[model samples]
Each structure stands twice: as structure tokens, then as C-alpha cells.
Target: MSDTCSNVQGYVDPNWPRPDDDGSSCIIIYGYVPSFALGVLGVVLFTTALVAHSYLLSRYRTWYFSTVIVGTVMEIIGYIFRILASKKNPYSVAYFVGQYFCIVVAPVFYSAAIYTLITPMTKRIGREYAPLSPKVILWTFIICDIIATTIQMTGAGLIGRAYSDGKDPTTPNNILLAGLAFQVFSFAVFIFCLLFFLVRSRNTTDRHFKIFSTAVLVATLAVYLRTCIRLAETAEGLLEFLSTHEAIFGCLEFLPIVIAVYIFVYWHPGRWLGSESIHKKTGKSELEVSQLPR
Candidate 1:
């Protein structure tokens, strides 16, 4: 799509002398007016998460969880841009790109934070049961995350350039799609490995390990769901149903992320695994009640 909003496929009439002259003339970059209410809600939830994470950081010094800090900050910035896009110019390319980059890539950081879990988890359960060394697993996923984040950033820059220069957005869109899709795939693999590690070690673990693992699982599912929603929206083309619908975004994307962040706070790593005095040794991290720690 072009900055003039003329070339945007499935959107823009391309005949209007002034595309953003009025809402009637063009559907706008977002396809619909972003809700100020939801934007505000995003700010509130992410801000609260940031504050909670800050406290946890200070108290526990679990620096490995720094990725969550990065994630929350991105969410806050993204939502701020969203609020601006809603209140000011929904058609402004700058605002759209700002929110796009921050919101879309924030989960990359979250995935990194989640990936760190395997190292300690493996150590707790006996690394011999894991198919690969815990450090190897951690680094592998984190590297994949870095690669995905780089791709998203690269695509974001190119898309902005494309819009500004009145060039075709197809290339950038493809890049973004590939990046997001790969991230989702990597996460699915990570989940599989996590499950495999747990199932193979079916003995039992302490309460702390269970709580810590549960937090990761819940947060992981929420983030995974959010990413899947995003991938679907992007894959369908910018002006399609998922992209145009604010309600879908609110329910699927926004709600899940908020739940993910808050869930982590409630079952925080710092609260559970922070002390590291868990009394048990081995087990899986899944639905089997017997495998769960008492």
C-alpha cells in the first residue's frame, strides 16, 4: 500500500483526490476506528504488569526474566501509539507502524523469557531425560526468537518505506508474514519439547517447580494464541476481516495478552521459583494430576 492510501489492495478507492480527507472517502489504515476504551485498557493492564514486574525484579533479581520487562514495555508503548492513532489520525502511517512494530514484536521478547524456563526446569528434573542439553535448548529457541524479531523489524522498516515511497507493499507484507509464521512455528516446537521433557521424567517435583511451570504454560498458551491470531490477520491481507474488525482484535489479541501478563504476575516465577527450596525432584508439566506436585 502507498502512503496516499491509493494502492492498498482490498482497501482504498484510489479515485479520491484526498484519501484521508474524510472517513467516508477511505476506510483508513486501520479499516475501522480503534476504540479509545480498549486502548486505555491496554495501557492500564500493561502498566500494572510493568509495575508488578519491576517489583519482582527488585526483590528476586531474577535477571533472566528481563525479557518480560522488555515485553511489557513494548506493550505499553504499542498501546500508547494505539491511543494516539485512535484519538488523532487513524490514517497516519506513522501511528499505524508504531503500534504495529511494538505490539507485533513484543511477544518475541515474551517468548525469549519463556524459553529461559527449560534450563532450570531440566536441571530440576535431571537433564539426562531431556533429548538435548538444557542450555542447548535454551540457546536454540532464543536464537530462533532473535531471528524472528530481526525479520519482523526488517519487514516493518521496509513496509514503512514502501508506504512512504508509494511503492508496492507486497514484499514487506510477505516478509512480515514469514517472520510471524516462523515465530509461531518455533513456539510450537518449544511447547512440544517442554511436554516431552516432562512426560519422560514422570516421577514428581516440588510445589515450587509445579507453580513455576504452570505459570509458564498458562502464559505460553495465551501468547501463542495471540500470535496465531496476528498471523491469521496478517496472512489474510491488511484490509481483510481480521484486520478490519476491532472486536476480534479486542477479544482474541488483547484479552489473551492481558491474561498472559497478569497470569505470570499471579503465579510469578519470582514468587514460586525465586526461593529454589522446592522439596521434590521429578515430573511432567502437564494435565496429569498425578504428575503434578502437591
Candidate 2:
């Protein structure tokens, strides 16, 4: 037994017989089943979202749906890496990097799509109600998303470097927490802005606009919930219960995102807001002025 332990060194290889609960080697022992299950579910949801976005693109010819598609693809790949990580080699550095990198940055694309929605919405309603012009809002929020993405990806890279060097990941984890907090703040401000527009708009009778706005609200809330969870999880540091526990991750991160993706698909703005025919026929001057990208 001593010979086997010495020969294996510090690594936990999945091909070898399972090792005893030595506090130093294994991060998780029996939670692979649940991880695999959640990973599979994530793949399925993201794939469905991808297909839906593709169909929307072919019919609507909107560039914004492509952003959602990119996010879905990232999510699918991220979960695939998580499934690999669940195969008894939870300590595998490759799997860890793949999962965290893709998952953490994927939502930035979704936020970009959300930001695009505001342009047409402000045009459809009234530009006066918005604090900034639609084009300004679009660029501002998308740039914020880019900054958040860079911060989170840098933190993930730092964490990977620290892991490889056998150093403490606390600093990188704090960086990740900052990125998550930034996302939460951005989404919160976005929601407030949307609410302000909703309250101030005189054209509330448009059912399609109302439904589209509701969908955007729900999706934003879902992402906001996930961001808050990630913020709390990372704020607790890598060794804490929220960071180590898989079930909590599945509930907070995975579930909220899946819900958000489905909401966007079912209530896709392109279906209503992207229709050139509807825009042309609209008697309202404000809605007529609203132009979706071809």
C-alpha cells in the first residue's frame, strides 16, 4: 500500500483504483454522478437554444441572434468539460480550465444581446424616456460587458496559473468575485433603466412590445440571479462550502442560466421586433422610427 501511494505521487488518475480519503489528494469522492447529470442537462439546454437561434436567424436575418448562438455554444462546450472533470479525475487541470473559462465568459455574449434589445425598444417606445440615446446605450453596455469578460477571464487564467504552481488561489478568486460583482451591478442598473422606460412610455398598449419587454426583464433577472450566486460563491473563496459544493453550483449557476436561455428562445425579440413588415406598417411614429439590423 505504501509502495502504491508513493508510486502514484500526488495525482489522482481516473484509470487507477480509487484512493482512500487522504485529506491531501482528492477534492471530491462521490459527487461525480450528480455533476455528470447536471452537465448533460446543460448541454441539452444550450443545444436547444442554439437550434432555436439558428432558425430565428434564417427567417429574421438579425445579427443579434448570433450573439445568443455564440453564448449557447460556449455553454455547451463548458458543460462538456465539466462532464470530463466528473470522471473521477476532478483535479485535472485541463478540464478545470476548460469549464471555468467557457462558462464564466459565455454570459457576456448574452448580455450583449440584451444590450442590443434596448436600441429597438427605445426606438419603438420613445427616445425621450431613455437617459441616453439608443446607440449610446448599446455601445456603453456592450463595452461594460467586454470589460467584465476580460476581468473574469484574467482571474480564471490567474487561478489556473496558481493551481499549476501550487500557490494560493485567493487573489484570483477575489478578482473573480470583483468581476461577478460588476456584472451584478450592471444588470441591476439595466433593470432599473428598463423599469424607468416602462413607467415613462406612453405606448404601453402595444401587446407585442409589452411581451417582448417582459421576456427581456425575465432574462435579465435570471442572469442577475446567477451573477449574484457566483459573486457569493467566489467571495467565500475556493476552500469554502459554496465553492466546493456541486449541488449549490447546479442550483444557482446552471439552473438560472438554463432558465434564462429558454426564456430568450421562447420570447425571442427577433420574432416581433425584427420584422421589417411590422415596422413599416406601424402607424405610431416612434415604432416606425425603430429599426432592427438586417
Please give the CA lDDT of all the candidate structures.
0.77, 0.73
Q: In candidate 2, residue 244 scores what lDDT? A: 63
Model 1 quality (TM-score): 0.85
For candidate 1, the per-residue lDDT at 102 reads 92
The TM-score, computed over Cα atoms with residue i paired to residue i, of candidate 2 is: 0.83
Candidate 1 stretches greater than 4 Å from native = 1-27, 275-294
Q: Which tens-of-lDDT digit does each residue in 1-294 have in candidate 2?
A: 334345432334455544353322333222233378888888888898899888976766667557888888999999998887666457555567778889878887888888888776776777888877888778877878887888899998888776655566779888887887888888778778778877777365377777777888888888888888878878877756776667888888888888888887777766666554455566233333465344
Residue 105 of model 1, lDDT score? 92
Stretches off by above 4 angstroms in model 2 are 1-34, 276-294
Error of 1 at 92 (Å): 0.8
